[model samples]
Target: MSTAADAPPALREPRLVPLHALAAGIDFGRYFRWRHERDGDPFLVRFPGFGSVVFTGTPEGARELFRAPAELLQPPLPNPIEPMVGPASLILSRGTKHRQDRALLAPAFHRSRISAYGNVIRTAARAELAGERTGAAWRPGTRIDARAAARAITLRVILAAVFGIEESRRRDEYTTATTEFLNSFGGALFLVPALRRNLYGLSGWQRFTAARDRFDELIDGEIRRRRAHGDNGTDILGLLLDTRYDDGSPITECDLREQLRTLLVAGHETTATALVWALYRLHRDPETLARLRAELDTAGPDPDPLDLVKLPNLDAVCQETLRLHPPVPIVLRRLTGDFELRGIRLRAGDTMGVALPLLHADPAVWPEPRRFRPERFLERRYGPFEFAPYGGGHRRCVGATLADYELRIVLATIIGTVRLRLSPRFARGRMPLTVPHNIATGPHAAITFDVLEP
Candidate 1:
């Protein structure tokens, strides 16, 4: 097997690479594309705090990395999002514990369980369309921020699905706390670890910790109430409370908090960003939007969201949007044991991942990749490695099923309900660079759309 010395070519000298790493965090697609074009697949790059990582854009490379033994891979420690997700989060755990946690949480997101929430999804979308938030009333000629609107809709759906918090008062409280917690950790806090330090209660980290504490208090109170009342409902939290390990012990409160937080954070933010991108892309391309609208119109008024999710053109549009702008642009795994890939040997502690942007844009896999074309998805089915908006393998997103279902339902509902066009300023504007927002990357500026009379 090839040794460390035989690793893939480096993007730059070690000293200069942190600069590139910072750039990647801001605009991953552009940076990864530039590096992949120059260094070819499986190039090595080092971050200042994190160690050397080899990223590949080829399907073969993705297949190898994802197929590696589950025992030999784990999410890299001191992960930037560790603060946001907490240590016990399944996203960070490993080995037997990870498997057990995954199994326990899997049922909550099963297709059947998610399908049951179709009404919840559609209700949330309709509420948003009718102006749920301040200044968001959808009158013709009124401009609304797509990202904020999408976030509001998704937040409601996730809150209802996870905690069964359908009461407006309680939902508003959770929304306020959760939004604050998420907003506290901005891109700077994520990209520059130094900014994560608590400085006399004035630092971003301090604000985030304060917000987290409040959010935790709310969650802990809910858990205690549920336990006291022996509440056993079908929501994810209740499901988790009732579940037991092989040893017959229930999950600890600490684990429960982390898991719930993970569900709220990962479940909503990523999907919201994708929704925003879908709306942005569709508005920018009238042809694709018209095609999707036509498909939705055929479904008739007041169609069940379950049926909306099955519409081929709607699915193709969501898939195509994800290809161009995956919320998480790369999937990384730190090696726990030596591994070899594409003739390069990587040692324990080294990182390996697939850069989704490069993989999605590979000319061999996607024709006219830069162009906004939803029909490509209808023409041929792509493998997981070729188009993984959610990462692949055992560590693939637990909420994948629900996210996919929600994206299609919500997108279709909004498009079918009202006529919207990109605000004049954004109508002819170039697509904005994506930057870190909370945990996911999204269009840098607010994407605004004007409600139009049908």
Candidate 2:
């Protein structure tokens, strides 16, 4: 509750980047480089006239920043998602609200639930990858749109985890539409420039909200039908309904909707992105692929399909992919109040976002940051805060572990059954989120692969 004037800015962030470069792309590292590429300083720039500055070094500043004053340095969620995800989302909440939401939500994400969700992950992976046919006519250098393959299974896994839907019953067309709607809302980043004058005058949020609004009728209808049938809510919804706040109130329907929306957006898209990166890296580095294959083959068949989260190498591939191509390449934090550390000054109400793409790519922090080495994570020397596609601290991703489990299971199950290849020239999407060249982003040897019967 401290304002900028009361708390005072004390942290001295080195002037690493100019403010104007933020307009280019969501991930600045993809487009520009600062003077000292090793330090990766310029990549982690601050927006002028913001509540705080971005620190993209080792975990030192992140640790200091997120250490919980309970007042200043609020969670840095984009305002655009508020309408889509509802205020109940863990990502959008700050302070007491965050704590309350997290308490109610954490039970479903506990280790026990993670264990329970494993079978769901495996089944989803198999169901998606099982239908194809392999032929000797297929050449060795063939490639598939692994991103699409990854996204399909990931979507089903999350839905199964949250809604317990089976492959036969899954609504593919509806879900695909839903996914595109949420991802397209990222366009608001472009709208940030059009907001002139008034702070409350939200720019083009109506459009973003509309994208998410398309789902409300469907979601609300489901909730209403479940309530009407006197059906026991079974998925994550069942868990949320069973929880109570410290104030002794059962969560309202609105809250459940927000959390579900949050899970849909964060849970699926992120894992899909990483899986695409994982498959991309695996195809590019055959040694990594072979070793990963050996790990899956050696682990034997896991009964609970979701058991892929435990393989150290499988875990390593996910870790390495996340290190290289994070779904969330930026970490945004708004100042709750004035605060400072590392000789840097921060004021309340200022917004700061870390270029995670650059930090993960930092050579000083990660040796040969560009190399696809899963073993680097095996060292276990790196802190969770140090290497995150997921954000850090109390605001860290609510589904981080589950996302990991989902990614690893998909990687193991698919690779265990079949190999993939694609045409090199068919490479899709020029930027971070790989789109298919034809139906989906694909085809450079890195982006595509052939699915082979192992």
Candidate 3:
């Protein structure tokens, strides 16, 4: 067994390798697979700006990483998403603070709360299908960008269900601000830190900061309004407002802003990307699509969103899509003490992460790993370590429940309502490489579908 004294060798010229490995548009899954083949498990990889990281894709490695003592792990610093999610986000917090915040925020996403949002999810999806965005009804022969449509639906759903923003004018304001803020920080800004400079207000960094300020102003105004009016509504924000720390103090304004930003940014984009992938995969395989549609039909035309969530095939399809294209492909943690993963031992400050693409595609666990097969999920149950699309353990995504509920509900709503096929341009073309989009990764080009009938 390898010990700290016999740590796995680092990839040759770690600096040069990561340039290709982390390149903006490269196929990351292919790169990771190639690396795994060459180096085997528990190999060391180092990104240019980030320090050495030991990555493993085996289920055993994931088990060790996820079960590690919470106090011994923290998000690796100089993280690219820090600027977007903010310093106080649950993603960035560690130790006792993280536990307290998570406990306070967990209830807002409880099954009951999420079940209530089913109607909101369905309403947003149906509105998108009806051409509410462009005001021209979608008709036969109309080609639409699946990602864009899914984004519109997800953004609306998150704002309505999570933030409880029902006023039309305020919703539109948030839509524009959030879209602008996210767009301002392109892949270049995320991948290459040097490109984040503000060159006389012309740089990507400058644009992102400006957009963030506008979005923050809106959030702050809403928070202040709620505080001033003592309006304790039932959405996430209200839950946070009602929460108190063990010390009996309310959450500070800064923490509230960051947490809300985290939910807003992390909540919608990842789910939207997953929805697009689901649509693309479903259309690409007629057999899978037929099966899913058959399952949806069993519940009838006007099935409750919650009922759609319970459909076995629908749940399997969603799980399969997440396995194929996890929105956040890697989960990283910096060590606070000595630890070993898959026999590779490491000391304090050493970093390690679970590479989801490799884990999800392990041939031993998933026969025909590259193939799209939802039946595998229905055939047998997978333990959390074996198949965790939202990551795992204590720090697993706080909004995971809401995201899963939304994905199932929204996907069912669309598949049941629309009769569509992949646009010819993308019908037989090779799958586009997934690229970084602000915080999440998605298909390089828009996945468009031709509306056959509705």
Candidate 4:
């Protein structure tokens, strides 16, 4: 019940960055660096429409913000994401509801059971690679979009392992609807909140709504069918369908649909993007790629999938990829009450976030933070807050275990089998997320790779 008026004047932030710096084509790192250097840690950045936003990268501040009581602080998802996913999503849920939903959903993503899906991940990767264009089939200057290939593999895994939908027709319909729903993200309109309104039947919001409608209908039908027949398998969907509250009552349909969509969206796009960057970076650096293949070759022609994931160097590569280019660069939280962070007072409705990229680039924390050195991970382990590609604390990504398992397995499978090299001519925007060719941005990396041999 405390208000901003109770905060001492000594804790007020001393500087603010103009909102225009966040416009398209701006370098997010440079912008953060500019403000951080001038104002020090826990500085404020003002966006005209969004109001005062506190940005922090130091460990102390990050820990305070991330560990703050749920009643005092809450995750701040953008308006754009809410429309894309749904209002009742666990990602948007807060307080007791958030904790309950997380607990109910925890059984499905348990690490022990997820390892059983390694074959599913491997199978999906191999199938996608089998259909991919290889050196033997390439024309004069053909390059395969690694992002698309990665997306296909990850999407298939989600549909099978998570949804548990073995029916071909229903699966295909669901896939089509899901793809359309994801496509609705990005674009200039996504940033301009006012432009979200439907006008003359032409609007990003309208397109998103249509896609959501299609996806909702397909997923709802699948849910109803599963309910009538009962959950016969151990997929995430089946577990969710059977989840009950402490009162022994079943979860509502609306909550179930939102949770499924949350898993699908979070489970696919970010992991797929990280996969692309891993492949791209390895290919871009031939020595690293050679070393990785050598490590795989160490296990002979046919290594156990479990053994493949355990390879130290391969694990290092995935770790480095995530450290330098985390899919979700920022973890946002909004203050619900007056909060004191590193001697700075943040009022209710003020946004506070840990800028992952900047923290990863901190020299004091990571020596040569800009370099892509996989060995750093092998040398020493980073604390949860120090190397959190998947945001930390209670709200840490629910799919973290599954995602890491998939990334390592997928990388091991693809690199172990296919001979890959970076394409000579590279272009951006191939993927919806605009990760730079040299580094990661947002979720997707838009680099292409040539499949030298199968």
| C-alpha TM-scores of all predictions | 0.97, 0.81, 0.96, 0.89
Model 4: lowest-lDDT 10 consecutive positions: 431-440
Higher-ranked by TM-score: 2 or 4: 4
- Over 2-80, each residue of candidate 2 has an lDDT whose tens digit, in order, gives 2234332333233432333343233344443342253443223334323233454456655665563756656554453
For residue 385, what is the lDDT in candidate 3? 87
lDDT of 1 by residue, 1-454 (tens): 1233544443333346568877887688888888887777778766655556788888899999999999999998778889999989999998899999999999888888989999999999989888866645788988888888888899999999889988989989998999999999998888777777868878889999999999999999999999999976779999999999888999999999999998988889999999999998999888889998889989999998899989999999999999999999878998889998766777787788888988899899999999889999899999987989899999999999999999999999999988998987788956788988878999988989988998
Q: What is the C-alpha lDDT of each candidate?
A: 0.87, 0.62, 0.85, 0.73
- Please state the error at residue 20 of candidate 3 in Å: 2.8
Off by over 4 Å in 4: 1-21, 132-142, 166-168, 427-445
Write the number of the candidate with greater TM-score, choosing between 2 and 3.
3
Displacement of the residue 415 alpha carbon in candidate 2, Å? 0.9
Per-residue C-alpha lDDT of model 4 across residues 1-454, encoded as one tens digit per residue: 1223433354343333234434322455566667677767766655433444667787777788778887876766554357666767877788788888999988888888888888888888877766632323332244667877787788888988777765657666776887778777554444455667787778777887788888888878878888788754678888877778888888898988888887887788788888988887786677888889889889888666777778999999999999877877767777788887787766787677887877787788889887888989889998877888988888898889889989999999888877766766542323233432211245333467666645
List the candidate numbers ranked by lDDT, top first.
1, 3, 4, 2
Best by lDDT: 1
Number of clashing pairs, model 2? 44
